[model samples]
Each structure stands twice: as C-alpha cells, then as structure tokens.
Target chain A: MKNLFLIGLCIATASASSMLAQDFSAGSTAKSWNLYPEKKAFFKAKVVDPLCTLTGSCPDNCSSGKRQLALLRLSDNVMVLPLKNSQAAFTGAANELQPFCGKDVEVDGLLIEDPELFARNLYQLQKIRIIGDTKWTKANRWTKDWRAANPDAKGKGAWFRRDPRVKAAIAKDGYTGLGLETDEAFIKEWFE
Target chain B: MFKTSILSCATAALAAFAGPLFASENGERITITGEAIDTWCYYSGVMGGPDAVVGAAHHTCALWCSAGGIPVGLLADDGTVYMVLKIEDDDHSNGGDTQMTIASHVITADGMLYKRDGINYLVVSKIIADLGITNLNHEDYGPVPSFAIPAPKP
Candidate 1:
C-alpha cells in the first residue's frame, strides 16, 4: 500500500512539472515594459489571421508570413491584436504566432488597456505554448527569421544598413531616393 | 539636421512629461493631425532620414511594411510619433484595410492617447479628415526606396 501511494505521488509530481513547463525564455522587454506588471495575463487562445476574421478575405494559410495574426481568447471570446513581441525595438508578433494559426495555444503576455473613451486593448505576446503541449514558444521569432533570410548580409551595425534590398534601392534611387539631379543639387547645397 | 535635432530634444522632453500624465487609469482624449507612417522604416531610418521617409516618396514602402505586420504610426505635425493601437473597427494595427487605405495620407485623428515606456499609443476612434498624400516629397525624393516599387517583368 505504501508503494502504491509513492507511485501516485510520483505521477502527480510528473504531471505538475509537465503542466508548468515552458519551452521559451522571456526576453528583457517582457518584464521591463511599463505594462508588464499590471497587464500580464496567461490564457488559452486560438491563433488566427485578423484579415480573414475581420473581413472575409481568407487566405489559404496563415503561415504566409505577410499577413497580421491575432489571438482569439478562449475565456472571453474577444480577439486580441498582438502588436509587439518580447524582443527589444519595434517588432511584431505575427511571425512568432504564424505557425500556430488556427490552433489553440496557451499565451503568456500582456493585454494593454486604456480605460478612457474610445480606447482599444492591444497585446504584447511574450510566450506561447500549443494547447495540450508541455513546451512554450517565446514570442521572439522576428530577428531570428530576419537573420536566416539575410544570410549574406553579414557584419551589420544595424540590419537595415547591411540589407541588400536597401542597398539596391539606394543605388537605383540615390541616397535621398530622388533622381540623380535632385541628389546632386542637395549634395552640392549641403556638402559643398 | 538642426531642425531634426531640436525636434528630437523637444520630443524627448514632451514624452518625459506626457508619459506620467497619460499613464493614468483613464487615457487622455485628444485630436491630432499627422501622416500615417510605416513605424519600421521611420524608426529604423533604413530607407532615409525622417524627412525623406514620408508622404508620396515613402508611400509604397509604408504600404509594404504595414502589410508585413509592422504597426502603423501617426507622425504628428509636431514631430511626435504616436503608435496607433487600433483604427476604428479594425482590430489589427497592421495589414488591415483601413491602414492600407490611409498609408502615407495626412489625417486628423480623434482618439484616446496612452503613453507607456516613453512611447505614445493612439487608439483612433475616428479620422476627422484624410488630407490625401499632402506632403508631396516624392517630387524631391522620387520613391524613397526605388525598390519599394517592383520592377516590371521583362
């Protein structure tokens, strides 16, 4: 009987650990943001494309990497727009939540609210976990995906400075993006 | 450059003062006129200086960034950048029809303003006016990033 009790205790412990396990670590911004303390919330939600939900402009897949995605909270049936991620700087959480489109996931984040007139609530997704799964995914995929896509653009002070697209555009349109004549005039007036 | 420096200093001061005032339980209501800008390129300065990245010159790029899930910001006439949380009934800040429609257009927005971490967040309840691509900088800066307009297929 003692052995049976020990076995049950072991199962309970394992289950609790599994239930609490989070796969991803939160970034500094997750805790440092002003709203983190008062607005943070963890709940179950389904990832969905906002365009399709708002208007019937449904696409084949949410993983298209272009459209914005939102979370439909299971508890209140309210759709939350995740404008930012856990990463520093201004980045969105679309790519982070894209893979889980249409699937229910556990989201750990903040629902920023302004209680005055005409104020709308916005979300900052810090961590996400697929429903029924033990691991949580951090909402920090923008930089990683950007780095992977621009493998050749290395040694960047800022990703923009080294980006091939930006370079090519500048080359084609001059530094000011104006025609050559305007650029020459501006340079002569400012520098010369 | 001198103007930009002064604006930057002024913006910093305003933000420092405004942050606490707006952070109250109830957000402050205000009406502001500004251009709907692409927050990514505007903040990153990837394409060009602040002056070059607005109006018709940067309209195409603004659309691209907004479509790619970068939240749209309203660059007020006073040089303040208000990160738009939501516009009217549209829930998402980026890639929404409303955002796409107003990309680079100068609009008078009536909304509730919330400031957090020195960043201003505006929830636009109504667009008082859309002054349609008023900044005509394209004449001086052609497409800010020429690549924003796709090259025609051969």
Candidate 2:
C-alpha cells in the first residue's frame, strides 16, 4: 500500500508538470511556434548597426528623452520595430528606419493580441512574443543605394558590405541560438 | 524547457484580412468573425473598417522571424467563420500579385484561437475602399456596419 501511494503521488506530480510545461512540437497547436525551414538553406545577412538617436542623452529627466525607432528590410520585405514602447511615434521612427534595413532571418516569435505595460515602465509589452533564434551568415554582396531610396536623408546609409571579421561577430552575438529552449524544440524536430 | 525570459514578454498586435471594409446602413464597424481551421488555434476576429485596414495592412502582420504566406480563416466578433485561405497579406498589396508575400493568424476547427503573445487583436481597413464605396476593387460589395467610425468619409 505504501509503495502504491508513492507511485500515485509521482504520477500526479509528473502530470501537473506536463500541463504547465510549454510544448514546441512541430504540429502542436500551442500558443508559440518558431521558424522551421521547409528546406534547409543557408540564410545570409548584413551586419548593420541598430541605429537610434538618443534625445537628451546627457540631460533632464528620462521622461523628457526620446528614442526614434529602428527599421530594416530583408530582401523586398520591410520591417519596423519600435525602439521603445510608443505607438504614436511609431510612424515617424519607421520613416527614419528605412535606411537601416537588414536581411530576413529564420527565427520564431510569440505574437500578442494587444500591447501591455508591466512594472510601470516605458518598455511596454507587444502583442507578439519574441521567441526562437536563427543563424545569420554575412552578406558578401550588397549593391542597393540608399541615396536613391531616401533622397532627403542627409547621411549615407549603412555600408552595403562589411569586413569578414564583423560578420562573424554578429553571428556570434547579435542573435540568440535556435535551439536548447522549448520554444525552438520545433526547429530540431523539423530535421528529424 | 522554453524559459520565457523576464524581459522578453509577449504582447498582441493587429492582423486582419487584406481587403476593404466599409460601414453598413446601420452605421457600425463591420465585425468579421470565423474559425481558422488547421492552425495553432481556432477562434478569430476582425474589427475596424476601411481606415483601420489602410493603416494595418502588410505593416500590421510583421512577425519577428515568420517567412510570410500562411493560411487564414477570417471571422468577426460574433464567431462567424469567413473563408479558408492559404494566404493573408496584412501588408497593402494586390491579391493575385505573385511578387507579394502573405501571412495569416491561423485558427483551429473547434473554436480555439492561436493566441499571438497573450492577446487577441483585430485589423480593420478603411471604409472607402473596403465597402467599395467608390468601386475600388470592382467586386459586388455588401452593406458593412460601422460603429467604430461614424459616417465613412475620406
């Protein structure tokens, strides 16, 4: 009787853990999913600085400061991510982010239904969850001219190409790894 | 285990079908609801009319690492499934254009929704083009409701 009772307790504890645990199965209809490439292919990218202008970098209260925004493009796709949680200023920053476009990466993210705030801070939560990560190779070729894309912007755009060493650094630091997390278990399963 | 980071939180954004929405005679935002079968979740919705779509198109459905182009099952607030689609381009673009890429907020068959982040949101288009007020697409448009906005103008 004692042994049976111990086994029952173990079974119950295991079931409860599974219930709370997030699953990353390939076909599971869970809340999150990652980038599982249909066919394994090497995805290349250009390592450009995430550009943002700091308002009053060395001045008054933090509320009086502002950070523009960041925008990038992967091939023909245009991407706009706000530097801070401010929807009203998203468009203006998006307009400036045009020049800092980067390449498309194969990763996964959790999307939210609405934007929310936590702990009373400017860094608010978005409807989408930032999940998964992918390896990004260096771009050996980039010929697009930003001067033509943004005639009014003053400075020249990011260097179309970068030194080989910088590419390696970005691959190592810029992105989180694609595996070892439950959110990305799908990626490993994709290969199997 | 997928350790959700303390800083890396989840949130919801807007994503509606890539089309025009206009006001009905009753003057309310045309609420669209449906089921997204064969998706992570099932229940779906679309609020806001033409103007909302104009703003949320393509730009609204940008995923962190999504490769674009996914099936969609549109719906309204009342739980009505619209259509089963393989492509949902939230970005502003033509339907049949091959160069365009699309994505959809997938849904399941039993009425469960694939919650993006931790919230559910709707994407609304502009009235003039959505309701075909001025015959933008040439399709026989229907009478859409409009509570979100008063008389559709501009």
Candidate 3:
C-alpha cells in the first residue's frame, strides 16, 4: 500500500510539472488558440513582400524590417501574415522567411480568422520549410532610380515617404501612421 | 504497474485541459477606451459605411461578420487597435452575438494587455459601457442592413 501511494504521488508530481511546462513552451495551445478559435493546418504557398505584392514596386532597401513578407495562397490570392513565437522555441519565423522571399514554402500553423487591412488571413507560424524557389529580384534593384527621382526623407519612414498611400494617409491622419512620429533618441535607446 | 498507468493517464488529462491557463502571457494591466469593430470589415476597408467601427448602425452586419471567425477589434481613441479576445471569461459561448451587442459602442475596459508575435491582444477583465449620446451611433441597421454611404457631397 505504501509503495502504491508513493507511485501515485510521483505520478501526480510528474503530471503537474509537465502541465506547467506545456503552458510556457512554444506552440502552447493556450498561447495560440485560447482566445481565438484558430485551426491548425498545413499550407503550401509562395512568399512575397507585402509592398511588392501589393504595389508591384519593390523598395531598394529590402531589409527584413522594410519588407514584411507573407505567404500568398496559390489557389486564392489570400495572404497569410506569419506571427513569431519564442525565439528559442519556434525560432524567428520572420527571419526564416526573409531568405525565401518570392520562394514557395510549406508552413504549418494555426490559421486565425482575423484578416488584415485587405482581408488577408493572419497565420501563426509554427513550422516552415522551403518547398521550391521562384523569381527573386536582387536587393537594391531599384535603388538608383528611386533615389534619383525622389527627395530623401533621411531614413524617417524613408522606404514609403513618397508612396501615394503614405501621402494619402498623411493627408487624412496628419502623420504617416508608421513610426515616423517616434523620436530618434528614443529609437536609439532600443537600437544602439 | 497499475499505478504507473494511472499516473500516465492523469498526466495526459492534465495536459489536455491545461491549454487555457497558459495561453496568454498577460502584459501590463491597462484601461482602454475604444469602439468595438469587426476586424474583417475594418481591415478590408469594405466597412460598407464611413466608419468601420460597428455600432447599432452596423450591429447586424458586425454580428454576421464576426460570427464567421473574424476577430473583434477595439479601435481606441489613440488610434491603437486591440484584438479583444473574450469579454470576461469564456462563459458566453455565443461570443458573436455578445460582441455584436456591443458593436460600435464606446467602452472603457480594464484588462491585462498581452503581446504575442507583434500583435496586441487585450484580455478584458471588466468592461464598462459608456452609453453617452456621442459615445454611440445608435441607428440600428436591422437584421440585414444595406451598405450605403449617403453619396459623398457631390
């Protein structure tokens, strides 16, 4: 009887620890699906930078920050914005996607019903693997032309300073709606 | 052996039910004032009206749109949009209706804010309806409201 009791206690302790660990671990259902009824599924799609996909205009500096890439469903023109999980756990999915911009990849994640500004689906990326490649333009391809034609806004939302959408947004909201209003000193505290 | 089997089963059960408890890492406690809007319509720019923030004017449509899995958003006065998860708890299974009932109405809610993957979610603890006349656009658009933007002053 004593042996059995010990075993039961051991089991209870083990289960409790695992339950606690599972809650904090990456891909925790609680973290991904507790609020929204997100469904997990596998998807194969080509990754494209939002600006290039939307405006057919790729900026010269196609850094990760400037180029937010999302998956474009092949069958439908649906966009999937991948969300990052723990850096140590799920890895930085955004960084993983950067290299594969314009390449086809397979992603497994929880599909949120939430849509972006244009009804694009929001996908919480869990696992991603490149399936194939597509036409990838070299970075800074338009640097010379874009610079020559436009006045420099000096890295203050520089990528989109001249965009018509940005101009219209400024006209309506008084600001670019980007981080242009953020102080350079404040930005340095975090960056430098 | 029997004890080991029981332990395994208990552990499995605990893991299965432990999801909600760990889902959100509640950030700072905050009080935010905003209008509840259907994320789909607001983001898609097809709000079918001038304001995407649904109130009685767009309540019925908000209900239908949100019922289909679209997230409900709280567009705050500061221009910050928070994705509101549950009202208080998960008790109200018919969340679509509950959300639509408060659509476009200005609300001041106290909650724990959470940030996951660059997105901000507000795990609302308490919500207070601010039913001031200006706080609401009470023009109930009926069960199936038509989208009309009273033609721009042409």
lDDT of each: 0.65, 0.22, 0.48
Candidate with the larger DockQ of 1 and 3: 1
The i-RMS of every model, in angstroms, reads: 19.0, 23.0, 18.3
Docking class of 2: incorrect
**TM-score of every candidate:** 0.49, 0.21, 0.36
Best prediction by TM-score: 1
Q: Name the lDDT value of residue A4 in candidate 1.
A: 48
Best-to-worst TM-score order: 1, 3, 2
DockQ preference between candidates 2 and 3, better one? 3
Best by lDDT: 1
Runs in model 3 deviating more than 4 A are: A1-192, B1-26, B48-53, B91-97, B132-154
**In model 3 chain A, which range of ten residues has the least summed lDDT?**
A84-93
Which of the two, 1 or 2, has more TM-score? 1
lDDT of 1 by residue, A31-139 (tens): 5355411255677889987555534446677737656677876754556667767775446778888888899998877655443211233567888889899877888
- Give the root-mean-square deviation of each candidate in angstroms: 17.3, 23.6, 18.0
Error in Å for residue B43 of model 1: 14
lDDT of 3 by residue, B27-146 (tens): 678899887765544543333443534554454345433432245678776556776655675322122345544555578889877653335566677887654113324233321234
TM-score, chain B, each candidate: 0.81, 0.20, 0.61
Pull out the clashing pairs in model 3.
A30-B23, A31-B23, A117-B43, B54-B104
Lowest summed lDDT window (length 10), candidate 3 chain B: B142-151
